[model samples]
Target chain A: MVDIPILMIGKNVVVPIQTELNDIGAKKMQEDVLYKIEKTTASGLVIDVSAVSIIDSFLGRILVDTSKMAKLMGTESVIVGMKKEVVLTLIQLGLRMENLNTALNLEDGLNLLRKLQETLHGKISG
Target chain B: MEKYQDSRDSGQGQSVSTTIFVASYEDVIVARQKVRELMNEMKFSLLDQTRVVTAVSELSRNIIVHAGKGEMTIIKYDESGRRGFRCIFEDKGPGIADIDLAMREGYSTTNSLGLGLSGSKKLCKNFSIQSTRGKGTRIEIAEWK
Candidate 1:
């Protein structure tokens, strides 16, 4: 079972998926990401999947569920670096992930999160 | 990890095939990797490779999830100048009683998105399934280059 590493930067946490994860590994990642979000009280979450070659229904569901769980915990999540082929397969599988925020890369993911935070802050302060 | 390779000639053409035993999640990953390698060797487009590999992931996982175990045979075929890859999954578990219901989206006996069968069908160019209650199940999927 490969361990997916989670790194915390400032008020956000980034998880780079570096290998094709088995079912057990994928579930473990969900649990660990949620636990890290709670432990750090991160305001944003970025899941990087540039290295992942495929996203089947199982993994796709986990990502959607994880982002939803993170939202409930007050952490906005962005999925980043999905390969073109992976996205094509996901759509062909009829799995729709409409609720998750996405970006092309980690930098874009972080920037989008920052923008989201600013909008929330403005809502509160202005 | 039991596997073997062989070459055979069918009416369509000559083919090379490999069979992998699927009994665990780790085996599923192995199955997907082997399929990807074969697709790459066949010069399948990246999109086609991803589509077939993802289908293999779902189908192989079904062997572990629905059935206790199964075997997957991957064949690389050159039929009259046409090249493609084919995968056959067979299991001796309690087979699906209702094929129509099982094929329906969101229909799952196990707690899942229930897209394995139907979704995999959509991912490949050719798909077929045969199952008998208390007997076994076999699914064949194929894609051409």
Candidate 2:
């Protein structure tokens, strides 16, 4: 129920939050994803939150926490393809998401992730 | 003379139109209807109307279930270029200590979805709350256009 594995499409990485990422699920997923990103040192992570429609204050706070987790592990997390209704809900809740990266769609998100990875690769190789 | 009388009476009518309410558990649905009608009179958009209704439902339910009793106030505001309403919910209940913890997802003090305060916050343009342990709590929510 918690800690689903990160998916790899070529070099792009995706983590889908399928249900309500409440207390226990959020904590467990944060640990697992942080570990995976640190181990792979992935260039970018696309968090697919499309499955989650209603994100309460707790879920929103945990999301902010998870993003921080990714940053500490040297991976950039980008949230992709949020429903407009959900966005409106989040804005209403005063859920501060200023620290997270948000993308409009999956392809655009993947492109951006790929770009980040390429840039990181160049820096390391150079 | 007729126009003068109409203006004076119309002004009085407008004041009467804007009435505040404090709803009990049984009165929450009616209270929500009143808020919806208020929004309609203000010509707020559909989304704004829905937001206010949703926020009202969540907050009112919280007052009933968590605090056992509470009071709600509806006031009109047009201070800024925008015009809308300000709703205040006050209750003498088990106050929220860890506001931050309470704000987190999945953290519910009751059997409810635990999304009451947070959801209410999201439903309005301006959301604020103040609470003390065993003292009481006050929530303010506003929607403007």
Candidate 3:
């Protein structure tokens, strides 16, 4: 998988969830993701988990927890491009993804982030 | 915690069920997935299913991550009218000192999300854990319909 650039499109922050984000390896990534959310104070976060083939219990739990964490930092977390196998494994394992919003592709995910940003902006302006 | 009103079996059956045992590395994700396969075959209730899956995954992963290396046994109980699953995960690493502190959130030995123990407790219907200082650790979780 190609390296996903942690770039900002408008006010939305995009992060790539590569294979390196597994188990303890995920701790560093989580820190970085958290830092971006706090630094940017972005309205939304788009995490690309398409490169993650397996969402183990720890990884699955962290992903879900990260979403909650993002909310606390004033950013909405959205996962994009999760494989069918990972989704099935998550379901079979009874992992909780209900709390997090997901999108089929980066475009859809970014759109939701953009919408969230617009809503936040509207709330602030109006 | 209030105990639910469910029939308890003292193991008075003649038939024996299949058991799957595996020992893996200190990788939480891999351990979690293995238990998920077993949970699916059990056909648990939606709520029970999620709890059991999370519980199994958490306990199994602990064996690997904390204990260094461990073994898990997945047992199927088909005898009698009550169908259930019984799992015993054992590890041979430095055991826990204070179970209470370990159970508490933000008291993790490792830099985990710290939800492995507490979240797992909420998921399992019957959960029991025992650990020694240097001996090992064992955790059992059972679910019934």
Q: Report the C-alpha lDDT of model 1 over A51-76, residue by residue, as the tens digit.
A: 99999999999999999999999999
Q: Candidate 3 chain A — worst ten consecutive residues by lDDT sum?
A: A18-27
Docking class of 2: incorrect
**TM-scores for candidates 1 onward, in order:** 0.96, 0.51, 0.60
Q: After superposition, how far is residue A43 of candidate 3 from its true place, in Å?
A: 9.2
lDDT of 2 by residue, B42-110 (tens): 888656665677677667667776787777777665433646777778889988898888766446887
TM-score of chain B of each: 0.93, 0.79, 0.75
Docking class of 1: high
Share of native interface contacts recovered by each model: 0.96, 0.21, 0.06
Window of ten residues with lowest summed lDDT in model 3 chain B: B14-23
lDDT of 3 by residue, A1-126 (tens): 223357777777888865534345666667777888789887788888888655656777777888899998888878899877657655554456777889999999988877777888899999
Error of 2 at B120 (Å): 2.4
Off by over 4 Å in 2: A1-5, A122-126, B1-93, B96-145
lDDT (Cα, tens digit) per residue for candidate 1, span B38-132: 88887888898899999999999999998889999988877776788789999999999999999998888999999999999999899999999
- Pitting candidate 2 against candidate 3, the one with the higher lDDT is 2
Report the Cα lDDT for residue B39, model 1.
80
Error of 2 at A26 (Å): 2.0
Q: Point to the candidate with the largest TM-score.
A: 1
Worst 10 residues of 2 chain A by lDDT: A53-62
Superposed Cα deviation of residue A119, candidate 3 (Å): 6.3
